[model samples]
Target chain A: MIEVKELVKSYGVTGVLRGLNLTAPNGQVLVLLGPNGAGKTTLLRILATLTKSDSGTATIHGMDVAKNGELVRQSIGVVMHSPMLYGDMTVSENLAFFARMFGLPSPDRRIAELLQRVEMDRRADIRVRLLSHGQQKRVALARAMLHSPRTLLLDEPESGLDQRARCILEGIINEFRSADRSVIMTTHQIELGLQVADSVAALERGRVALHEPASAIDIAQLQARFSEPTEALGAL
Target chain B: MAEFHSERGSGDQTETAPTSEQQDSGSPGVFVASLGVIWAIARKDLLLELRNRDVIVSIAGFVLLVFAIFTFAIDIQQADNAELVGPGVLWAGIAFAGVIGLNRAFSLEMERDTLEGLMLTPISRDLIFLGKALGNLMFLAISIAIALPVFAVLFNLVVFRLELLAIAVLLVIGFSSVGTLFAAMSVRVRAREIMLPLLFLPVVAPLLLASIEATADLVAGDSWSEMSQWLQLAIGFDIVFVIVSAVIFQFILED
Candidate 1:
């Protein structure tokens, strides 16, 4: 459901995504693994229609990202490291606001369902700033799913979560898979990413260094390959 | 690994595809939906303002400070002239102090960078601008409400009367329409606090002059028809600036 072709994006003289291409089929998750400054977030931003690529084109569900951004926006749900919610507003308020933004029908029921799905129904009235990081992530998750978007885009979702929180996060990711929805997530968590991805791609220097079915490569080999020098990997 | 281009129906553009804006404009309910989104967003902003009370408190304190300082600075000997100049000083203080509140209005969104999050929604960017502008207008209304009584007693100015209050509201809306637009633009700049007034003041000079003239007329009990041109100028700027700023807002709101 997500597509990119020979995309080149840059900031001034610095190139972030240089002649890159990627595709993730619907009904599975594609986790982008890369080190810091590897343009993972840049790639996701382009797909999210938040940033326009310098050249080439990216489309979500076969519509040009730059030209059809509004449709792309409606189809995709995004969760970044930040909760992207008002700290002062209650959990229910955040969801209600977003529900209204999406013009969802019967928002009260939808908000209730989302809060319950994220296991945040109990704290619905509590202010978001008062919630713990894990709790905030839970609320954030509920906010992202409120619109029932066809595609999910997550950036560094597990950045600060503990093992238990990671498990919860993984469960949310797994839920998307079971529903046959497309998910594109960018994270540095190796084991967790591999566990959820139907296909995995590793980015190096803004180019896909490795792309394959998750079942084709074990975590041990992936780790060892990742540790090797850049020169060892031949031309793409 | 080879670059992962799709094997099925990737490059071929969808035949039925229409831009989301086109879809929205084509829809009959688009106007109502946009209005709903605008009001919903504005309500969110108002809720945040009520919770923090930070912007309101700052504006109130600064407005009072302006009044108190003006009271002490104006010699009792020049009481008549001070009363004559009161309307201008009152607006000057409110405009300057209110812009501070406007500058901090989006600070909540700046914390988690939620503006970009709003951009990801299907709502048009102009609606977000209107929502925020309305929220700021509310803040200005609150400050002016408090200042009206205090401004009268402190400076011996006759500003609380109905006609003058109407003029105040019109001028406030005019100031806020452009003020809110520039505040959003300035908040993103590095030197934002300094940038806001520098960008805001010059554009608002005509409205300020009209406000002073109209308020002067009301204070002097001059014929309403005599102040018609000033009222027309104020209303004209209010309508034109609001539409222009609403349209221009979309261009500035980008990731």
Candidate 2:
């Protein structure tokens, strides 16, 4: 399980997350919907331990993120806007590097399995720079799943993916849910998010504007809410 | 099949996870594991360097340029200045060229945002520092290895000696330890190229001085024992900075 309470973050004088509160139960997908600068990425960064919240509490599996960062990191995986990969390295080499860092047993077997799942096994020897954006994104997803983390935090993961890659991503997220793991993803693709989300929350002005089961959210109304006039962009 | 994979993948993955006992007990298992992580990082760096030759090429090119410029500027061939100033020039040149290598260390991480990927791993920050510093030290040492012959030819001095090798190791250690830390700290700054030197050079000034003195003594045919004071200074600098840099690296990498 993942829990966040009274989360606040700021860059300089601008506030990004202002006392936001959220909870993601295990065995489900919670999709965060927010306009640009709504702190979606910032929220994921904080949860991933890539960045710290100015003031708040975030815990994964009952361990406080701030206090048990390394332990929390062991259980959580993250994919950001960029692929977060070395372009010069081959796909398999990239996976092997992370697998070694995570200290995974039988890393070669694990790498091969992940590459097959992501449909990149054929291009395993090709440098990442030679791959298309969608291909790179798929490899990034493979990298995140290398350690078999209990929670996956994906920030705009679908940005450059094609239809086929989108299907693979959905399959991966659904797999996470089926295993009783937690997946917290932020996306601008409302339809795609709603399709896979068990729960949905809309973020506005650094707080949860709306939270409900995915079945309960009215997509048209939710879209209208975010489209309405904004005071200004939040700090990104 | 998906269910099986997910279930198998879930949980602690304790095969590699460091237990509190392993950490506190300082077991051989933990020690070996730490070395493995350090090697993984260093190997990744080595692989990248081999593919692009960016860091090595830049360091080598810079060292050659420094020697060439100093060779002409000092005009040491006309007088006995080669024996007197050659050691100082060699150390100074290596020091400045090293900054180029250090600057690229973290900047490459910033380029594709892979640093965040590394940060997400469970390993401690000190290990990461060691791995990167080790890679940087190797590059510096290699450049110096190549430059020594050139230095000997340009300055007309015998640069090959066991004492010089010992001093070189100390110099590289001191350079890399502090260089890696400052490089990560300044990576995000707008003027990082300028910022790295400003941050690194002043800190390594004493190490540079000790190194130059020791090298000069070696060039003067003094025995290694006679340069003990300068060697001690260099060794002390390496130890202190390596410990301090490794300990504080976590903060430098923190958001």
Candidate 3:
């Protein structure tokens, strides 16, 4: 299980995550909701072990995020809005490269399976630069899963996906959940996140303003929660 | 929500996923893995450059042209001057061509956004730096090979000996190490073209100076005893830069 206690991160004089605390168990998806600059990305990055917290403890399983960052990284798969792909490489080439990086056995077979799962097997040989935004996202998803990580952290994963691509992404998440992987996804697409997420957490000015089960929070309540006036002084 | 489990099952785990304890047990495995990653990056870059041909051709052409210019600029027929100036011209060509190659080494990664993608992989940052450095070294080495023949042909100088070869290798290693390190730093910054030369030249000056003197001594057929000091200086410069660059590279690579 992922456990966080009073997680705090700051950039110079500006604080991002302030005493943020949350948890996600296996076999479920936790959707993080927040507007821009609300520390959602920072929190997720910290969880991915890409960024460090200033003054709190974040433990993935029982390993401390700061002390056991490599362990945390070994267990997590991350997909950022950037897609973070090599445009010069073909989709299949990119996947194989990451497979080798993560030292996956039978990388070729695993790559084929992921491409087929994402329904991009036909375009696997195409260079990533030629792929559309949705196609690139699919490739990124496949890249993330190369190691078969137990925890998935996606930031605005559905932003550029078309309806079909979105459906494929939802299916992927569903499959991960069924396989007992814990997922923490951040997105502004409220209805889509609501549909798939087991729970929702909202951030406002670096604090968790609202967090509850998806069933417990209605659309109106969610919308109103985001509408609350963020204190200007605290908006750094 | 389901609970997150820290203990991952070993059955489906790939060989890359060594348990945390194994990873922490001395770091030899990590080092070996890093070397593998570096080799892959260098190999990939070399394959791409072989296909593209622009960088190799341009750098080789530039080094040849620089030698031609220096031939006219310095009348090598004068024995005293030829012995003193030959080393300078050789190194000048190398340094100039090296800068050109290093500048373009990361051009592909930056243009294609491959750098960001590489960073996201669990590979250590040092591996990325080493890989890029090795690729730059390969490019520079090839340039040196071509330039050496061209220098001999253009200058009408027969300074190609075993000692000279050793000095040339030392010089290239020193130049490429700093070149690769600074290239990584400049690739991520704005005004990179301006920034790279600015950062590289000052740091690499001592090595270049030492190399030129050593090369001059070798050309003069001076005994190893007399030239040993400059060779030692080159070695010292190379080791210092490599260690410094290895430690500092992560800072430059981190977002």
Please identify model 1 stretches exceeding 4 Å from their true place.
A218-221, A224-236, B1-28, B76-79
Which prediction has the highest lDDT against the true structure?
A: 2
lDDT tens digits, residues B1-255, model 2?
Answer: 342264336445554745333466788889888888888888898889999888888888898899899888897977679988898889998988899988986788789989888888887777888889988988888889988899899888987888889999999999989999999989999999999999999999999999999988888889878899999999999999999999899888878
Please state how well chain A of candidate 2 matches the true chain A, as a TM-score: 0.95
Q: Write out the backbone clash pairs for model 2.
A: none
Q: Of the pair 1 and 2, which is ahead by TM-score?
A: 2
Task: Provide the overall lDDT of each model, using Cα atoms, as 2-decimal numbers.
Answer: 0.78, 0.86, 0.78
lDDT digits (tens) for residues B48-139 of candidate 1: 88888988787888988988887788763474666577778788888888878988886667878788878877666777888888888888
On residues A52-109, what C-alpha lDDT tens digit does candidate 3 reach at each position?
Answer: 7889998977879777665666677889877777666678877877776666645776
Off by over 4 Å in 3: A227-236, B1-14, B17-34, B51-58, B76-82, B111-113
Candidate 1, residue A145: Cα displacement in angstroms equals 0.5
**Model 3 chain A: lowest-lDDT 10 consecutive positions:** A227-236
lDDT of 3 by residue, B1-255 (tens): 111221222213544633335545758876576667788888877866875765677678888888888788888787676676778888877787777778887777777566766665666666777787887788888888888887877766677788777787787777777888898889878888888888898888888888888877777778888888988998999999887887788777654
- What DockQ does each prediction reach against the true complex? 0.27, 0.56, 0.29
Error of 2 at A174 (Å): 1.1
Cα lDDT of model 2 overall?
A: 0.86
Docking class of 3: acceptable
